[model samples]
Target: MLRVGKKTAEDTQTPNNEIESSVTEWSEKVTSLLWLINADHILPQSYVPEGLENLPNSNVQVVEEAGRAFVRMTQNMDEPLYVANGYISATAQQNLYESKRQQYLEEGYTEERASMVIVDEYFPGGADEHQLGLTFDVCTDAALNLDVDFGLTPQGQWLEEHAWEYGFIFRGAEGAPKIYKPWQLRYVGETHAAIMEKLHLSLDEYLAYLEDKGTSYFSDVGAMHLDLIVYFTDSLSEIPLKIREVSGDNNGHYIVVCYR
Candidate 1:
C-alpha cells in the first residue's frame, strides 16, 4: 500500500538547497511543466510558475502547457465545460480556508470540528496545488456547484474517461485520503498522464511506484513505446545523459522520461 501524508525529512531535501556534486551536469528538463504539488509536497507562498496563459474563453489561467492541453480537451468535448477556479494565490487559499472554517463554526460546530471539516475540503496556504498554475476546478452549465454527485454527470464522467488523453487527471478521487473532488483536474503532461492511466494509479501512488522501482518503466501505447526512468538522489550528478526529459516528483526524486 502507498503511504499518504506529509513527506518526512528523509523523503526529500529542502527546496532550492539541492546537494551539489561533481558526478554529472544538470539538464534543462528541470522545468515547471511537470511539478507535482499536493497537500504534503506544497509550493512556497511566493513561488509562481512561468509561462502562465489564460484559458481561451475563460477568466482562469494555468501554466502554458496545461492551458494548451485544456483548450484541446475542451474542443474535443461534446458538451460545454467551464473552468470554475484556477491559479489561486497563497493569500487567496488562506482566505478560503479561514472562510470555510468560520462558516462551519457559525453553524454550531466547535472550533476543532470546524477545523477538521475545513481540512477535508480546503488546503492551507502554500500547500495547495492551485498555486502551481496547473490545476483547475471544472464544471458544466447544469451543475455549477461542486459536489460528489458531479462524478455521475455526463460531463464529469466524460472527463474521468478522457482527461488523461490531454494530460489532465481527476485529482483527490475516492479511496484516496483526501476528499473526493470530481471537478478538480491537474495537469502532469501527456506522458506521465498516460502511464498513470495505464497502471490505474493515482499521482501519489504512481510517484511512489517510480521511487521504489528506481528503474525504467516501459509501457506500450498503440504503436508508440514510452519509457520512464525515475531517480531518487540528493545530487543532480546522479542523473544520466540518456534522459530526454526530467521532472521533479516534488517529494525528493527526479523522473526522467527517456527518448530513443
Candidate 2:
C-alpha cells in the first residue's frame, strides 16, 4: 500500500493490532491509461530506482483509480513493492514524445518531459507487463500523443473525441469491459484503426467487439461508421476534408478529411 493517506481499523484496535489494514479513500475505476515515452539517443534515468522509494511526481505515481487513491510504485524490479511496474516504452514512443513536445513548445506548452527505463532497471519477477514493452506509465503532461485523435490529455478530451483517427484504440469505452484506466491506449493497427474511425467506437467498444463478435461483424459496422463520418465531417463543413474512401468495405483504409 502506497499509503496516500491514513488507514484506520476501528479505533478500538491498537496501532500495532491493525498493522495490515490497507485502504485508499481516493481510488476510482476510470476509463483511462498512459503511454510510456521512450527515446533512442536518450536513455531516461529509470524512475525505478533503489529499493522501495516513495517519491511522488518523479519516483512513483499517485494515480486515482477505482474511486480510491492508491500509489503505484515506480521502482526497479529487484525490489518492486508495487503490484505493477510502470511501463518502459520503446525508442519510437520516446521519439514521438519529444517531437510532440517540441511542437507544443513551439506553440506554448513547455511541460513535456521525456521519461522511462534505466540501464539495468530491475523488476522483482513474474515477467511484469512493463518488461515486455507492452505497457507505459502516463505522464502528467496535458499535451501527449497529438498524432492520435484519442490523445491522453484532458485538453484532448476523451478517446471518443479522436481515437479512431490514429491507428490506436482505447481498451474499453463503449458497452463492454469494466471501466478501467481511461488513459490506457493500445495500438490496434491501421486497418482496425480505419474501421474504428469509420465506426466511431471508443477503445472499450472495440475490444468488446473483438472478444464477443467476429471479423465478419465489420460489414455491419462499416455502414454505421459511414454515418458517423458523414455527421462529424459535415460539422466541419467550413473546413473541407479530403474524405477519401480509398477502399471498399473489405479494405480498412478510410481517407479522412484531414483538416491539417
| Candidate lDDT values, in order | 0.74, 0.32
lDDT of 1 at 105: 91
Say which candidate scores most in TM-score. Answer: 1
Q: Alpha-carbon error at 154 in model 1, in Å?
A: 2.5
Question: Which portions of model 2 miss their true places by more than 4 Å?
Answer: 1-134, 142-153, 158-160, 172-179, 197-260
Q: lDDT by residue for model 1 over 1-260, one digit each (tens)? A: 79799999966653333433222334444755556666767788898888888888677878888898898998998988888877988899889889888999999999989978887777888888888898888877534566667678788889888988888887857212567777788888887788888889887788778777776556573125655555644446655445555677665556766653
TM-score of 1: 0.81
Worst lDDT run of 10 residues, candidate 1, spans 14-23
Candidate RMSDs in Å, in order, are 10.9, 22.7
What digit string (tens of lDDT, one per residue) describes model 2 on residues 1-260? 55555657644354532322211111121112212121221223343311233234443322223101122222211222222223343343345445655565666554532112211122222212232232323433434322223234442253335434434455433211232344444444344566667666654354444434422223323323432221111122232332332211111211222211
